[model samples]
Target chain A: MISSIFSQLFQTLLIVVLAPLLLGWVNQCRAWLQNKRGAGVLQPYRVLHKLFHKDAVLADNASSLFRTAPYIQFACMVLVASIVPMVATDLPFAAAADVIALVGLFALARLFAALAAMDIGTAFGSMGARREMLVASLAEPALLMILFTPALIAHSTSLTTIVEALAHREFVLYPSLAFAAVAFAMVALAENARIPVDNPATHLELTMIHEAMILEYSARHLALIEWASAIKLSNYSAIGIALFLPWGIASAGDWNAVPLALAVLFVKLLLGGAGLALLETLSAKLRIFRAPEFLGTAFLLAVLGMLMLEL
Target chain B: MATFTGQLINFLAALLLLIAFAMLSQRRILSLIHLFAWQGFILALSTTVVAYSTHQPHLYYSAFLTLVLKAFLLPWILHRLIIRLNIKWDVETMINVPTTMLVGIALVIFAFNLAAPISQLADTITRSTLGIAMASVLLSFLMMITRHKAVAQVVGFLAMENGLFFAATSATYGMPMVVELGIALDVLVGTFIFGIFFFQIRETFDSLDIKNLEKLKED
Candidate 1:
């Protein structure tokens, strides 16, 4: 039992620490693709370290919610890290590894941060909150449908079970999963505030969704929130990997199987990061009004996946 | 091991059904959101109970999700929406209170009948309560259809989700973590979008009455 706890703690720390590095890698790759020297891969770590030592300045009118947002965001991300099958699929807390619960963690964090944004009563904050919700509204159904496909296939909702089922080649050529995959990718892009949903790199008020909301946060609070955001991006990527790839994850009861699992996980993360950067580079941000249509399409695809499964 | 927990699960399931009915009959938007929160609370409790009984850790996460999203986050968003939209007054309902109550009863009966075969198939501890859960879902849907105010409809929508969550917990233990997370994200995002919709409705029609939106249907 003690060894399991230690392993779990170690895995959580690895995810939290490695999350920023992954973000930096994505940024650097994007820069290289754009033919610019770009910020170094270690830049995010430097920025985080620098911010952690600074004092946070709160707005006089800021409510308790604002003060609590950073902690809540960080805590929720940590919770998410704990649930995701990062280093090993045989996590001690794998029983808590329900996809719907994981989505709830993300939602809880988003809700808090959005509330914090609106608490200051700034126009940008409210606007950002509104847009963020818009993106989320359509994304939810699509996500549900995507998850339903896998649940139906495995006849169980547990990620570990599903991963094992897939790794063991329990089923083949599920057309439903393919449709769900596309739909999931769309929802992921929107949920993470990527291009075609909201540009993560831009600061323009008219176009920003995620950035505008955090414009008021600064110092350590900003750093934590930023780090949490990066972790979230990584988490979503890992989620995609677990559902789509599901190979090479070591099952529980084999301590010796961890190293191989870790290596495979690392390779998946790298490929996933590069793929995300390439997708972002190739896509343009959709207009705010058009976002619903994008997510609507995703929802329909997910439904189609479910229908196919039923058939 | 099984019978005692099964009985407790049934009791909690009944409480959840009671809350669903209360939410359906509520006319005030604020109170409806409050009831929705209570419903979420019950869901969380029942989920926790199920988790403990079944030794399923994921159910605990499911309970946590219900607590945070339904009990805390969504209600908070609804409260803010009401305040921002200045919609604290009594909301308009499409159907009369008595008629709605009668319809709700009919829905309950229909739910039991419809869920009978399915519930019989379920060997879970909370199998008998599956009918109540389906009834709650149908009743919440009815509430949505009978409410003429946008806020009321949103509350009903949320309550429906609560019923679905209860079904998952009681009948099947809980959904996958990925699916739960996805639903939680969806609900949070849905609430925010609905909040914005409330604002837009007020701005466009100068009232919170969703009947005004019907004008678009005619056009």
Candidate 2:
């Protein structure tokens, strides 16, 4: 009991502190791929430190929701980190939240972020909120279908149960999971506002999605949102690991295996981060109108995955 | 142990269905042909596996025929035809892509429900894959109807043939070897005739879009 609690606390803290490092690693990789010297892997930490030390500036018309949105978003992301079975599946929080609840938590955070974006009444903020909603509506169904593919195989919606089912199964190629992985990668790219959906590094007002929503934020509020987004990216990567390549994750109450599990998770994340950078490097951003087709293809792929399993 | 090969066959069938969807939504004529080639290659691979597992030696010939005719020869000919014709535009869909995808999904469901009873009566280890084979066929037919370009439709037609070959392998362990050979010759001859027709049509209409053929009836 005590060890699981300790492990859970350790994972939560690790995710909070290391999430920015993952972001920085991805950025560094992108830089290397583009043939430029990177700002280094610790750049996110420096930016967070600078933001936290400065006073936040708010618009005169900003509502309380605007002030509180960052905290809600940050708390939601942390809760998600705690719930997902990252290095270990034995955490107490895993039983409390299944995949559905995890999605709901993400939706709640997005709802707050969109609401807050619209709160300022700025043209860019409202436009960003609308676009975010459009993406969420398309992406959420695909995400659900992707999760349900493994869920059906495991016969449970709980992430731990699904992980246990997939990890312990005899080596057999599942064409359905292959399709689901492709669909999940597409949804993840879009949900995280990565290149091909929305370029994170670009500030061109016409093309930005996530960046536009937070254009008015400065100092700590921006910092918190940035941190929350980093965590969100990690959460998605962890979910993907838990679902598809879950061989190395420590099972519940496997205290002795935690160290090995941590090593495996680190290697997986490192490879996954580099893979994300490579994908971003290879693909150009789609026209905003084309995002629907990209995500629609994702939805169809996920549905196809489910249908294959049914067959 | 018996279920292992069954699972692998299912996986391949799922891949065939995925390729069908990809071909359905693909816009470029060149990539469409590429996808068609991949579909043929997977079909050949699956047939080879089925042959090895079931000890049906004649199915091996069928597999080789699929590999050469569908995967290599057909794609090579189509590639040359497109290059010779100087056709580079995205294959226009009659409806939008998303709507076509939705209709494709509906067709898949219909195909599954349509095949379920027939699949239940089959005794092959790959009997479960019958629905996927049927779905791919229907999806290719959907692709055929939705595409406006002649080359795209022909690729769709070839993909539909691939689906039928998969169905034969899964359902009845392939047709008799002579019939397989005959069908192969027929497909090759049909492609040659289609190639001739392509030039004749382009010479008459100055374009490959089939919509231009409607003017002949108007006169």
Candidate 3:
């Protein structure tokens, strides 16, 4: 009993600490793919440390929501980190929320972020807010459909139940899951502001979506939001791993398998991060107007995946 | 082995339907032709698998004919037609892509509903794939109706044929070898005639858009 509690605590702590490292690793891989020497893998930590030490600069008319939005976003991400079965499926926090609730948490964070973006009434901020909402509206349905594909197969909406069912099942190729994975990858790219949807590295005022909204933040508030974004990226990666590749995650009361699970999780993340970098390098950013078509295709693929399973 | 074969056939069928949707939404003429070729390749592959698993020796010949004619020869002809016509970058669509995609989805659902009863009555190892086969046919027909360029229409027509071939293979262990051979000859001759007609249309209208042919109608 005590070991379960200890493992839960350990998993939560690991998610929080490892998120920024994952971001740093993806960025480093991107740089390497572009044939540039990268800042070390610890660059995100250094940046976070620097931001936390500086004073926050706020707008003269900034509201309380503006000040607290960063914290809310950060907290939501942390809660999500705890809920997803990353290293182990038996974490206590996994019971607190099912897949739908987890999606709600993401929407909540996004709503807060968008509300805060429009609070100061800057032109760029409002524009960014509109674009972000547009992407979210299109992506959210597809996200739910993608989640439901596995839920239908496992006969449960709880992430832990789904993971356990899939992990213990006999080996068989599921074509519906193949469609769901493709749809999931597209939605993830769009939701995370990655290349082909919104370029994360670009700060061009006209083309930037995520950065334009947070343009006014600095110091501690900026640090928290950036950290939250990192956590969000890792959150998505963990969810993908949980759904499609849930084999190595340790089940509850299996203390002997925890070490091996951790190693497998690490290797999966490493390969996944590099694969993401390769994809980003190979594709160019779509024009802003084309984003709807991209997300629309994702939605269609997800629906087709569900239909394949049913019909 | 039998179960694996069934699963593999289902996977290939899903891919066939997906390629049909891709062709439906694609705007570039060259890309449309490429997707058509890919659809043919997958169709031939699925036919080969069905042949191997069901111990039908004639399907092996049908698959070989489909692979050579639909996958290689037809695409090669279309590529050369596009080069001679100088219309490689055409992107005109009578309906926007997203709306067309929504309509395509509806067609797929309708096809599945329509095929369910028919598939249930069939006693083949590949019966489950009949719905996907029908969906691809409807989607290809939708593509044919939505595009303005004559070349895209031709590609869509050929893709519709692909869906029909898939349907025949999946539903009935393929047509008799003689009928398959005759249809292959018909498609090859039809493609040649279509190529000649494209030139005639281009020479008469000075463009490849089928809408221009409206001038031939009397007011």
Which candidate leads the pack in DockQ?
Answer: 2
What's the DockQ for every one of the candidates?
Answer: 0.01, 0.77, 0.72
Q: What is the C-alpha lDDT profile of model 2 across B106-175, one tens digit per residue?
A: 9999888988898889888888899998999999999999988899999988898899999999899999
Q: What is candidate 2's CA lDDT for residue A255?
A: 79
Model 2 bad stretches (over 4 Å): B214-219
True-contact fraction in model 1 equals: 0.00
lDDT per model, in order? 0.81, 0.92, 0.92
Over 4 Å off, model 1:
B1-219
Instruction: Please tell me which model should have the higher DockQ, number 1 or number 3.
Output: 3
Score residue A32 of candidate 2 by CA lDDT.
100
Better of 1 and 3 by lDDT: 3
Per-residue lDDT for A45 in model 3? 98
Instruction: Give the lowest summed-lDDT range of ten residues in model 1 chain A.
Output: A302-311
User: Candidate 3's residue-wise lDDT over A1-311, tens digit each?
Assistant: 67767777888788889899999999999999989999979999999999999999999999999999999999999999888988877678788999999999999999999999999999988999999999999999999999999999999999989999998899887899999999999999999999998999889988999998999899999999999999999999999999999989998888788899999999999999999999999999999999999999999999999999955
lDDT of 2 by residue, A1-311 (tens): 89889988998898989999999999999999999999999999999999999998899999999999999999999999998888888888788999999999999999999999999999999999999999999999999999999999999999989998898889977888999999999999999999999999988989899998999999999999999999999999999999999998888888788899999999999999999999999999999999999999999999999988867
Residues A1-311, candidate 1: write the lDDT tens digits: 77777777877888899999998989998999899998988889999999988988889999999989989999998888877776566677868758788777888898998899999999999999988888887788678779878878888787777777767784355656776888889999999888889998999979999999999999999999999998888888877878888887777666898899889998998888888889999988899988886786677557645544432
Error of 3 at A7 (Å): 2.7
TM-score of each: 0.59, 0.97, 0.98
**Best candidate according to TM-score:** 3
The worst-scoring run of ten residues by lDDT in candidate 3 chain A lies at A1-10
Error of 2 at A16 (Å): 1.5
